[model samples]
Target: MSDADLPFTAALYASTRTEELAPLPWPEEAKRMFLAQQHAAQHAHYQQHYRGMEAWIVEHGGAAIGRLYLHDMPGEIRIVDISLIPEARGQGIGAALLHDLFAQARLRERRVTIHVEKNNPARTLYARLGFTILDDDRGAYDLWEWRAAA
Candidate 1:
């Protein structure tokens, strides 16, 4: 569907297949590809688990500005990662993106869960959205979850 069809004021979400993100527009950390390649065997591992994947792209005024990745599960949808370009940070764009995400999840009666890097500022934003830290390991990071308070 076209961005114009999205009811959200700022962003549109398009759910798609995992293979579709093979050549993503996202920036990768240095050596990230090499590391992923080194564990190529694990590629199949992930692909098998998340057989269905969807990439969320945030656009504004016809310009692509952000992205997020997710996969549907038997009882939930997992938000793997999300990022917005530096220029768009702190513009209420992320919250709007997440608000739409939660609305979609709640409509389906599924909880929203995500992993947050300890140093990432988005954790603060997620907290404001009612996500609570579920687990933490100093070096690895933490898990946060938000359930509809029924």
Candidate 2:
């Protein structure tokens, strides 16, 4: 993603965390500021971990909608992060993108892996997409992997 995409990216990040922060007693501005800082830290962490990762902006109707960060490692394609605006979710966009990734992995004979938060709703979708848990990080996050059917 380019510098021009920062605002949209931050908005998407905030959307993902809105529900978790909603019940908190913080003011809206404070919550937004915290999310901005968290988003910056997350961006830095991804850059550090996936040095040569591929970045793609998910678009719909010619407008930017989300971001998909991927790393094509030696034996696996790691989905570093995937975020969609709240309005664009639940419409099968994410599933379709993931299915495309799965197809690509199959062609290359590589596993597709992702880590999802323990309580993230997307974990159910990943499981439905045939990803099996490879590691459970003590209830924080689960590492999931999907391999091409033999």
Instruction: Indicate which candidate wins on lDDT.
Output: 2
15-70, model 1: which lDDT tens digit per residue? 21122344776555433443444334433454576666675566789977766668
Per-residue CA lDDT of model 2 for 28-111, tens digit only, reads: 999999999999998899889899999899999999999999999999999999978888898999999999998899999999
TM-score of 1: 0.67
Model 2: CA > 4 A from native: none
TM of each candidate vs. truth: 0.67, 0.97
